[model samples]
Target chain A: MTNFPDIASIRKDFPILNEVIGGKQLVYFDNAATTQKPRIVLDALSGYYEHYNANIHRGIHHLAEKATGAFEDTRRRMQKFINAPLSEEVIFTYGTTDSINLVAQSYGRKFLKEGDEIIISTMEHHSNIVPWQMLCEEKGCVLRVIPINDEGELLMDEYEKMLSGKTKIVSVVHASNALGTINPVSDIIKKAHKVGAKVLLDGAQASSHLFLDVQALDVDFYALSLHKIYGPTGMGILYGKKELLDAMPPYRGGGEMIKEVTFEKTTYNELPYKFEAGTPNIADVVAAKYALDYVDTLGKDNIAKYESELLKYATDAVREIPGLKIIGQAKDKVSVLSFVIEGMHHQDIAVILDNQGIAVRTGHHCTQPLMSRLGILGTTRASFAVYNTIEEIDSLIKGLHKAKKMLG
Target chain B: MTIKEAQDELIEDFELFDDWESKYEYIIDLGKQFPPLEEQFKTEENIIKGCQSRVWLNAYMDGELLKFEADSDAIIVRGLVSMLVKVLSGHTPEEIASADLYFMERIGLHQHLAQTRSNGLASMLKQMRTYGIAYQAAE
Candidate 1:
């Protein structure tokens, strides 16, 4: 039997759980969109501003030294968190979208040529899809999509067929944001490597749920948003192989990313800094360590066990409801439950649920292509986080029933 | 009735609900009761694309007054469309262009009008006003 963390105490760490909305207790089931911040993460954000609010990496003064140390410390923490060989492999970005764009612009423009094929899955978020499409439009590369089954699992055989000598890169989501399918990244990376194609995993949804080891997975690139992992918004990490990052050009040319600037010639900085331009999101980056620390304290294994139980409970309960069909039922999935009810619009369901103080993400969820592929306009998704409890899932079930009765 | 009178009637109707649940239930009922727009009128030209739901609105001049017929895939937005049609459908173009919609705020659904909500209500309102101005210019 797996030991789960005390749900009562975990809920207390997130103050927003106590919030009352529409005369009822708030049940936040929108974890996939963004997780609620813990008190420790919040304190870290404020503490940095209160104590050492100064420019990092440039200044030699006490506040600057302290701030820079704290900021760099997050990079090291992230390196260890994802098991990257070098701290320099972790490039801080605005978010996962920014990270993907960085790779698409820097790596794609530098290496990819005309008629080069890039493979992506139907389950990828718009962040992963649009950047490559933009690159393809510019570079004249062919974009191929790996289709999925009705159950939302990626077809491995079809993906194999799409691979060839022309395939330069294969970018796929590690875990689907709309559906909860935890993809087979190990096999995916190995297959891509066989064809001499680089692989980039959109780890935005997977980072919080799965244990990430970049070296073990042998992934060329992995992008994640810290906000979805119980950290502040506007901060993300892009893990690229050291050799690959060194070869790529800088994404944005600015102060931090530059080595020396002359009117005639300019030089770029090393490894991670080449991709990260500007002063960066210092406060959020510094505070993000605490969010990772929070996860560590809970033990990722314990958290995952509890969340899977929650997902199972929710799936079983919702399946019993008449005319409610689940969208994704993969054997392996994260703690996300997406479903569509007959004769009830997803937006209408969201409005009704919101009235009961139960928040579940409704509509296409930035996965319009995935929605279209599934022959659906959208689905009502309730994603669970570490802080969420079985009682909250019960409230969601109750709220959904109410929505059905009223809409019916 | 004038726009102000129509808005007042809606406000009075909303005032009957003691709780948000009842108010939403009434709104959903209004959505069901509202007639669907004609198949021909539900064209791409008439569609207002919101993030969550789509609203299709068609407007024409009935003599001097503007008549609006709208439908939405989402029930709540359809109810809001019904409310918009009730207040502005029978009014002159000049009156509609100048009319202030205060009923949504008075009825405690001003949040729906927020740009961030993206339920098509705000966009639909803009479309209605745009139609009013366009018809006035044409006249």
Candidate 2:
């Protein structure tokens, strides 16, 4: 069993922990869906909306300038946060879905042709899947998916076999949202590069928990959602190698995204703005810095250590509960734990847990294809964050006992 | 004037039945209360994509008032339309434009909904708001 994290001081930072749900203190385990915002993030959002409520880049006024400075500051902060090569490589988009769509629309449209293949793992979220499917359908490209083993780890042999001269792009998630499997992305990147295929790592789940240095990994592209990292909704960042980013065409055409526009001829803006077409979720983007800072303050290693302990505790506790089967037992994993009771419906379990003020994500988790591969409808997923405590896991264990007694 | 008033109406109507199942039965019955929309409104343009239940929504501006006609393939979802119409219909463009949606939470309608269903409701509301904006811009 791993050592329990120092969570007493951490819990004090989150005011929402004091909230009561169904007459019980909320035991929020759905950190994968979206994390609870800390006071720093909330304050940053309020500070922006109340004080610097103006659009960026174009305006020459005071608040506009302040907003513009704050916005670009986030780009630089994100660059250092992920250790990107440069700020220009960072494209602010609307979460992971939008980031993947941007890549598929711009890069896939520009580079991929008929009979060219794109590879992805079976563990990819639907966000990663649908965009490629749309591109493949539009361009006549073939989408070749790398299958995973029963443990939810990518089959490297299959992946190696799939990579050839026909392969153009390989997109895969760095960590599984439903299964918590930490994919061996560095090795995957090296292999893909040897085959001359560009790689895009969906870092949505890994951004908050793992140490991400895009340059060190030499990953072609990386996409992450700020909301899942304890930031506001409707914001995400995409990091690409400068050459590839510059070569890609513009995603959306509008005022901020163009240098010049005529009815007949239009010239797009440079790098990041080429993908970001209109006024963004300015408040959220500025406030995301606070979320990043919050993570930095706690240190990802320390947080991971604490969460690993919690996962082991929960895993061992649930093992004693008869008829509970833990899914995704990959040797290397993050803090997510997913399972199914022998005879209980996932939704029924969720309802009962919610009644006891525990929140766990129950369903396919936008990985219906993965669910099909696993031969199950869905599993109840409880993902951990920095602020989650072992006591919460104890509550979950108690709740499960109640659930088994009531249902079994 | 507020969602509370509408919720009071819902509760009164709910009292005419018992439990969520019978309330749902009443809601489906109320869906039958709406006039069948003209067949032309059933075109692809009116269909709301990404809904688990197939739903069609069409709206037009009658003077300064915005009128909407909606339908759904699912009985349960059509009941949602019934709730929306009672709260949304026969109001001025501005009134329908500025109505508070957090009231749905107060009534606990959205509190129990699946995320996708909640998203669909939000999309339906946004579509209604867009209709108002289009009419206002035209005027």
Candidate 3:
């Protein structure tokens, strides 16, 4: 057996795991949606709110200085988390949705011209698709989609053929939230760059599982949510190349983002502040540093290893259930296990599981297009994290049998 | 039963279960008991706006009373709608439009509803009231 983190000891860090749901112990298998916070992360949040609760930047007061320092400290931590070349390359946003929207507006809107192409995949969440669609509508640009195989793996050949000089932007998800497929992003970035197109990797799902190095991938932009990394919600990072961000226009207009105010013209602030408009989610940002530290303390490799074990157990156990079909069978996957029981509604499965205190997400999972492509409404998705165990998978298998017996 | 009486009865039924799981199972059973909404009525126009779940609520005036037919993609949401339907359907438009659904709180269901589910339930109630108001205006 591989050397992995102690699951029992690691589970102790998350107090929410001890919670009871529907008269049973909570079995949280919805990590892909958002992860439960560790005590350290929550304590960090409480520490900030209790001690230094004030607005960041431009305040001279002691509390303000303290808050600003704490807030900026998070940015530096995030920079190290992703191994970005410069700390200023990191721009905090509300979440992944906000980060992607920033890129779509600031980068896509300003640089992309008429008849240009933006290539995405069928597996992209609505957050990754809708913004570019809006941009396409405004800029008269064409949107191309990379097709996926039955296994939910992207067709690299089709993608290569689709790329041309007209393809100005190739935005793809680093890891699919619905499918759990870890895309070959480094290769995608290289190929896109070859066509003189910039690549934006939606790292919302990957950030928690993978150790990301922006310089190594040569990726132009990356968007991810910290909450999925066992951090706070409403705290996200948008890491862009310094030169690209310096050239792109500001996303939102607010006090902190502007360098000068005049009647005729306005100049935007430097690399990160230009994109960070309005009062950011400061307390959550501070909490995010602790979340990253928690992950660092445990080690991402250990988490991934344990989660992979859970996925293996789950996949094997679920497959044993007669008439249950697993969706997205890609070789390179995270811990998401999406499946549908024959002649059973996904909602029914979800309800049954919830009754057993096994929290699983059902329905399209914000990937309606992907569901449509699969010719199914949705599937019950049980995504595992480091805190989960084989016993939970056994419970899930038993729950599935009960659901089949009751509903069938 | 009258709308208030039906709501009170529901609260009483919910109290029988000591735990949320049994109560939830009972609710799902209630949902399952309801005849599925007719396919003809499940149109985009009938779909409730602001619902996280894809819930389609359709209503028509039956003489002086309004009859509501609804469905949801979520089983729990369907159960919630079934509860609403039991209370509001076959009631006078004025009664439905003015109804204060305190039974949810009394039944301990209000606290258990997820934010989205709460919003969905609110949207369902709003749609029911909108139909009531429309029927009243027509009269």
Best by DockQ: 1
Write candidate 1's Cα lDDT for B24-133 as tens digits. Answer: 99999999999999899989999888888999999999999898999999998899889989998978889999898899999998888895446888988988899889
Each model's TM-score for chain A is 0.99, 0.98, 0.98
Residues A154-207, model 2: lDDT tens digits: 899999989999999999999999999999999999999998999999999988
Q: How many angstroms is residue B94 displaced in model 2 relative to the true structure, after the best TM-score fit?
A: 34
* lDDT of each residue in B1-139, candidate 3, tens digit only: 8888999999888889997557767877877887789999999899874323567898988888899999876666688888989999999898988888888888877743445542366777878998888888889
**Would you give me the overall lDDT of model 2?**
0.83
As for candidate 2, its interface RMSD to one decimal place is 8.2
The candidate scoring highest on lDDT is 1
DockQ of each: 0.89, 0.04, 0.30
Residues A1-408 of candidate 3: C-alpha lDDT, one tens digit per residue:
244567887889999999998579999999999999999998988999899999999899999999999999999999999999999999999999999999999899999999999999999999999999999999999999999999999999999999999999999999999889999898899999999999999999999998889999999999999999999998798999999998899978988999998999998888789888889899999899999988988888888887898899999999888899999999999999999888777777776777789999887888989988888878889999988989999999999998886666
lDDT of 1 by residue, A1-408 (tens): 234568888898999999999789999999999999999999999999999999899998999999999999999999999999999999999999999999999999999999999999999899999999999999999999999999999999999999999999999999998999999999999999999999999999999999999999999999999999999999999999999999998978888888999999989888778777788999999999999999988988888988999999999999877899999989999999999999999999999999999999999989999999999999999999998888888888888889888999
User: Which sequence of candidate numbers ranks them by TM-score, best first?
Assistant: 1, 3, 2
Query: Which portions of model 3 miss their true places by more than 4 Å?
Result: A1-3, A60-63, B11-29, B49-54, B71-80, B111-121
**Sort by lDDT, top down from the best:** 1, 3, 2
Better of 2 and 3 by lDDT: 3
Which residue pairs come into collision in candidate 2? Answer: none
The whole-model lDDT of each prediction reads 0.93, 0.83, 0.88
TM-score to native of every candidate shown: 0.99, 0.77, 0.92
Indicate the docking level reached by candidate 2.
incorrect
For model 3, the local distance difference test gives 0.88
